[model samples]
Target: MDTITTYLDSLFASLPDNDKTRQAKADMLANMRDYYRDLLREGKSEEAAIGAVISAFGSIDELRADLGMPAQATATTTQSDPTDAEEEADEDAITETELRSFWHMADQFATQIALGVLLCAVSIALPAYTGGGRWEGFGVIGMFLLAALAVGLFIWGGTVFSQQKKQLNDRPITASAKQLANKTTGEYTRQFAAGLIAGIMICIGSLIPPIISAYIPGFIIENAGGALFLAIAGLGSYLIIYVSINYSQLKRYAYATTAANSTAWYHDGTDDDAANYWEQPHKHHQNTRARQDIALFHQVYWPTVLIIYLLVSFLLHGWAYSWLIFIIGGVMQNIITAVIARRDYSE
Candidate 1:
């Protein structure tokens, strides 16, 4: 099958790439596959079946003549009629298979990242559970394990995105493909809205325990309430991320993959800034790397801060001052966001 595909590619290498020619190539490949299968069913050797299929196709010219496709034009095409040139450029456009693979990878990446965040947020509260004395050791171990998992997820998801972007950088997105991706997300809109609302409510409701504990004296719900706050916030973040996936920008990304290479795409002088959004391998990689850096900081910084805060507040009995660390961490996070934006994608 691979050999047949290679042969077909070589045969049509010089032909004008347009809808009719694409249809013809598809038909030819199908016919070749059917013939090869028939030969195999008739007890022909694999080599013989392949050789017969190749011989049956004859030359490229013969194939073109048979398919009623015009012969490859030798003359330089004028700029006045850009249709043929535009059609030709779409030969290396993104296919349905690649798009599906991207979406699948994206979904996996999102779930892993969200889970990582959840684990990080919950790790600090593990010591408060299953008794306090020696189980604190268990909490430390749990925090280490969860942090390890979160780092691993960050690396995996970042690598997945970077590699996918590399493979798809030089491809264009077709109108049909764009529409299909848009429709796919559009179908889930109502569900996403409901889920979004529910997640926010869950986050808001997490504070109920603390508020109730203020009124009813002896329950001792401080740790539980704090843990609930982190857990619910993390869950709400996961919900927002999972539902807010912007699949439509995939088309723009596909085009931007090779925007730096002038020969790679036809500019035709329209909306140049928008067309040059992330600028191919170099700048695209910078943005991707920037994101990885930001994620790493979040994965490491906040969790470590939370662990310190929990230890000081619970064990050392420094709840009054330890809460200040969060404010510092939040400010640092905002700094990271700003730095990445300026360095990678400013104006």
Candidate 2:
């Protein structure tokens, strides 16, 4: 148990400092450790336990796929001696240099996210201010500016998306990796656009009703208008979560693609049988199946929430019940998605 714990610690310590990556490594290590410990408890000897652990670790290809990381170098250089595990641990500690580099990259990403939020907020708010609280006038300008901002954000997001995809597709495969990459990239783009659309819809939906009520003489938009806006806001929030999850997956795909390509390039033409490209060990880890499953789940999940909201509205108070259900469903969906993501991507 002591030896296994030490081995696991060293394995995790060597991983890079990105939160997702680190969590993945830790989960993998923990799973591996438990498997080995179980074997030992079943009367396996030290030698047998070590061999079993190594075998269960599987190929680097499987690890990369399961952990949602890009393929790196092969396992051909792995150490066999149990003592070497401790040594690997000692060498795994992050250097100051590596930490600095990681922090720099993180800072840049944070800045970009902040800027995106600011742009979106300003774009949505500008029309209301310019329209002087008039519904019709505000709606037109808001739609234009919001749509423009959405397009701009989409373009920026697409650039990030492409870069990530290229990273994954660095090596040429027998069309499978490329095909998978293309599909995943397309899905991600659509999800992002959906999020932007939802945001625009929510902002417009919320503002328009209030403005209309204010302009009309006998109309009371406060109750119904508030409820509609709330519903829209709920939908918009769900879209944000939906987009983020897909984006994260896209990033993982990119990393995996890059790693697979690097591995393929390293071993190029080493054997004639390996020339199939897609059949290569590195390419085999591509998660086309998993991505499809996630996409299908997302499609159903959002619509389910919407339907529930609508049903609740009809069964109870039209406006009030609808918003209540929408808000509740949005919160629940976010929680479920977070759990699934952790389970799927972690180790």
Candidate 3:
């Protein structure tokens, strides 16, 4: 039995290592052993039974057809081995420089999120300062400055994020290495928690001054306290946004790298012989297309909402209810995204 299994292993050496090949090997080896045993029971000598079994096994060519192997792999070696090559390519491992680059980009992405929170904060404070017909000129000037800063930060953050994405798409680091970094980087998680804590504290602390000002009974003091409260809330929200977005991007990069590596292996033609190009590769591309479509929807939808908001608020002077458009658009966006996701999954 040992001798027969050894010979079977040698014969199977050239075949792909997959579920089908494994099962076929087991079936063939079992049949060969059974035939040998039956020959012995029929009064044949050991040597003759062995020789008969060896002869009956026939050529590797016939075995290949029986096992349903590809015609190109006729020898004890494949033209290209995806698994071996991929493992070799990761020999250099991930460098500290690559990790540093990812962190920098994550910080930049976080900065953009912070800027958005700042914009919201400024907007919240602006009306209180500008609306009561007091210091109207300075209030307008402050509003413009904050708005300009917010817009500038948003643009800068977008550019930085784009660069970060391009670097990932280029695959500067291996997927395994990225996974390792994510595991080792306790700082990302710590920072996320710290940011959340600080944001919550500031938000809670900001309420104290307003509560005291409520008893003072002066418009200036009360309004000042309200503005201070809004500012504090905005800063807290910004901190939360900054940490959360950066953490999410870190996760996204890790997953993207892993998926890309797997896709590359599958495309190498040796890793998955059981699946045709369409069954696996086409489905991946279909997912990519679905994501792109959803992204396009967001790109178009948000700008349209902004345009609608500005036109209605400035031209039609419907400031009170114009904001509902955003709520409606958000609901529609969610529905559209869900529909797209479901349709892709179904197909």
Stretches of candidate 3 off by over 4 Å are 1-99, 123-134, 170-176, 184-187, 204-208, 215-220, 257-347
**Most TM-score-accurate candidate:** 3
lDDT of 3 by residue, 57-79 (tens): 65566456434454543443333
Give me the overall lDDT of model 1. Answer: 0.58
Per-residue lDDT, model 3, residue 51, is 74
Clashes of 2: 5
Ranking by TM-score: 3, 1, 2
Poorly placed runs, candidate 1 (over 4 Å):
1-89, 128-134, 246-347
Q: Report the C-alpha displacement of residue 185, candidate 3, in angstroms.
A: 5.4
Residue 245, model 3, lDDT: 65
Among all candidates shown, the one with the greatest lDDT: 3
What are the Cα lDDT values of the candidates? Answer: 0.58, 0.47, 0.60
Position 151, candidate 2: lDDT = 64
Q: In candidate 2, where is summed lDDT lowest over 10 consecutive residues?
A: 268-277
